[model samples]
Target: MLNADTTDPAVLRELIAGELAAARERTGRLTDCVEDDELVAQHSPLMSPLVWDLAHIGNQEELWLLRNVGGRDPMHPEIDPLYDAFEHPRSERPSLPLLPPKEARGYAHDVRGRVLDLLAASPLEGSPLLDAGFAFGMIVQHEQQHDETMLITHQLRKGPAALTAPAPPDHADRLPAEVLVPAGPFTMGTDTEPWALDNERPAHRVELPAYWLDTAPVSNAAYQVFIADGGYDDPRWWTERGWAHRQQAGLAAPLFWSLDGGQWMRRRFGTLEPVPPREPVLHVSWYEADAYARWAGRRLPTEAEWEKAARHDPATGRSRRFPWGDESPTPAHANLGQQHLQPAPVGSYPAGQSPYGVRQLIGDVWEWTSSDFHGYPGFRVWPYKEYSEVFFGPEYKVLRGGSFAVAPVACRGTFRNWDYPVRRQIFSGFRTARDAGEEA
Candidate 1:
């Protein structure tokens, strides 16, 4: 439930100003300890150069929100050719000539300031300029996106020494295994929402029969049962593709896991410690989730079913941006803001439960769905063509919600992300669902 009055020009300006301030502060922290040369070095495959990423954020705002709508020239016309991400995809990222680190930071600060001033002076409410609102939204999401990436990237470069240790896992209690959802029609996506990505538009109707979904993400203790039962060795539990992948890679369990003195230990950040049975299982790919589901006599929910259980407020036909409604996220609500930067004990945030009583729906670990990564009925390409069109096929599967490293704003209920079936470096996990009338 976003402020329905977000369209108020003054409110929008103030919001934009606040977000700009936050972005600057976060970005400053990311670059604070880096040297001039280190900023341009390729730290990891998951991250781009810090200097390049910083410039891209500012240039993106100028290109899409200001130039596209306000018809203004770029603050630095010459740098636009080098730093524009929309024009250069990730594959070409390494080859781009980058600005000096200090210069890049200054350019970003200058551009952000100019954009804020422009937004303050413009009449955005009813004018055609209103469409730029989406661009503003996009910029906000983009900045948060990099903030999360920076966290992971820093870990890769400096090892786990860069991050603070997470709180010890709590296994003192375990929640009920499942919650039953009644049979009904739940709106699947957004239609006329003030701001929605193209993938979330044309809010179509979907009817799902009654089902029982896990009240929380699968826990380490449960997944350990799968491993102990030789679940990975049994071909019957895996799809043909999954079996092939398992055999080819000799994967016996989740990455970053091992046995120590017959007890399970997992790698978090960089330290190895006893596996916390209550923590949601993580780093499992879609194939792994599917295999685990099959072994458990259940299945991953379709994106529609997942949304019906996790977002739709049956009483009002409205969905929350987060499972907990419109309030900005807090550490108490979910495992966001790098609070722990590791999966929390499942069901740790009862306040973050969705309307239908689905717990941990917003964050803990991203959940895999059975949906293919495809666009909606009237899908049209945005400025970044590669964003959606290139990934449309069986090669990728849809993932819902956000992971520990996810930024709060980027974890909105309708924001969609996709990954290849076998790539599982991300902090991903799954919950099980059974058909109507099934026993928990």
Candidate 2:
């Protein structure tokens, strides 16, 4: 809640610093799970080397915090060109001069030290970047995002499991099919959130008719039905582009799933096991989710509808920062921050339920929505153009609700994540929606 309560500058600074430190700690933990060689290895052509992301996180922090926010000199000017994401695609990162794991760790550590010092002396007002501690929050969010990317690299890497987490609490209760979001106009996006990125800015009212959203994300058991019904083979359920991509990729099941001895199994991190029927299905592309919705006689919720379900509080005509309430996420609330390598049971985390009784709307997996990644009405790029402006197009689909691999600081009810429809490496899933009058 970096900007949720920004009236007290001291408190805001402390929260910002704490969030930054926590994000750094998580990055270090994820990187430490593997050796230096693994860090340098490009796990997938689609993702940068782990070492590249490690340094790039530090590079971004230095450029934004030390250079822009504090008006300090660049720490390593030579490395700037190499780490620029747009300049070097993931496929070319390994061929570039990336700092070794040890050096990258030192650089990130040093950047954090300086950033903390700047935060201590920096006034928390003046420009928008400092007015609400936006820069610090942005840096924290950027690092957390990269940490999530690194986790994806780990997922794509062919190695023994290098990460570990205890299983989430067991919950056996069955969830209802859908929850009705009382229709009308509900506030969407945020004008007051200090650290909200450009795409999520300028709070606006979105009007929608009454609709029904799934109580929780589609579970593995539910997705299994789609596979059984030849959801992939049937062209009727897919969009033109989606059907084309499906045919080209020859996708039969989710990315890491396979059938062994007539039992559906999935590769989780480093081990293969029977797919957990109760868990939210992970690593599904937007196309697959869309087709599944069609097969189930439902549709992916529009971004507005999804946000309305997660943020709108019908009783008070207000939007909560998270599904549960205005308070920040707690351990009991959501399965996030890579605390668990995989999603918890779909019905778990009852405390995180929305006002409409929508469960797991904020965690589990990055739930897909039907909307494209377009700028909000009155959206304007602030601070930087590339952070969001570059990705504003129909080619990318929006995904809401942070996944288990997502960090709390990087997630909010308004936070937006988008990717190509064919991307299944990131933790993604979907829950279906339909008009309120529709029969189930």
Candidate 3:
């Protein structure tokens, strides 16, 4: 995590150098196979042109971190007019005069070299320049995000790469739904130990009555039961808003699923295969999850309740960095990093369960909560204004944990993410919760 102490020039140099190397390695692999023309094509709404994405990422380093903190000019001054993502919306991206792929690659390399040199010359001790560590971290994270986008885009435009490997199947069996969570007061939110997002601020107390959360996210097999029971056709299962959205879109099942031979098959990337019944159902919208919960006689937990169960310790204000503990994410702990590039069986990560034994709470797929997206008691906006404020309306719903594609750095227990209720293209699923009085 980038913090005040991380601003030390030595630390900054080493960190930035390592990140620069990683960025180059990933981008180099992309440019090797993807042609310049292909780099600029709009593969999908979720992805950006490779050329524009690469240039914008490099330019951001100069504009936000380097120029803002170090007082340096952008590598190509002309790029600021065209490639600023904050200034240019996705719809307007294709019209921009994006740099040629070769030129953009050279520019990125040059910017890294210049920034590294500046870092080397700067004082290591007590330098105010460290204030830019957030910006630098953001840049590194941005590049990593692009790396995933490149992977998805490549799969979309071409096919699954020869080198890419599917995520190993998780063979764990689902625990019964009768698992009980004891009634207790659990302190929720970040305790100000270190860097935390604004939404996780003003560490608060919450009391959760004894209740039951599903031992795992709803599996495809369970959802298939809903499908077989004609759950989608029943307006009773859906909220008024959900029913309207379903009718408008003609949604019959999870976005990636289709019926063939009276059996379910799911589209993974561009390839269609039999639905893995044991796997956690991915690409389900909050609306869909809500409907499933309604049909299953349950509801999504509030954000406070979810955090209370996952991170908070009522006695000491101690919370796990992830669901399991303070240790960072590992491949065995969660299905992230495109390791399988798909959802795994819900109970695969019993070791990563929360203190109350709620399983798969960290990753595999982001779990939806009933909470609306809003600022906490004393929420203050970070440098990026649009990050939270833009999605405060009902358009977005709260989601926890990380998904298969979410970066490790961005997947902390306290990190909050949101998406539209109707959008289900990403890796998302849900676990059901019931009122304390309700039977499991």
In the order shown, the candidates' Cα RMSDs to the true structure are 2.9, 1.2, 3.0
Supply candidate 3's per-residue lDDT for 130. 47
Candidate lDDT (C-alpha), each? 0.76, 0.90, 0.73
lDDT of 3 by residue, 69-188 (tens): 678765568768787666877667877888888888888877877777766665533433344444555566667667766765665564544335566666676477745667777656
Q: Candidate 2, 384: how far from true, in Å?
A: 1.0
Candidate 3 C-alpha error for residue 341, in Å: 1.1
As for lDDT, the candidate ahead, 2 or 3, is 2
User: Runs in model 1 with CA error above 4 Å?
Assistant: 33-38, 75-92, 126-132, 158-160, 165-174, 316-318, 380-384, 437-440
Top model by TM-score, which number?
Answer: 2
Ranking of candidates on lDDT, top first: 2, 1, 3
* Candidate maximizing lDDT: 2
* Model 2 misplacement above 4 A: none
In candidate 1, the residue pairs with backbone N, CA or C atoms under 3 Å apart (3 or more residues apart, or in different chains) clash, namely none
TM-scores for all predictions: 0.89, 0.98, 0.88
Worst 10 residues of 2 by lDDT: 1-10
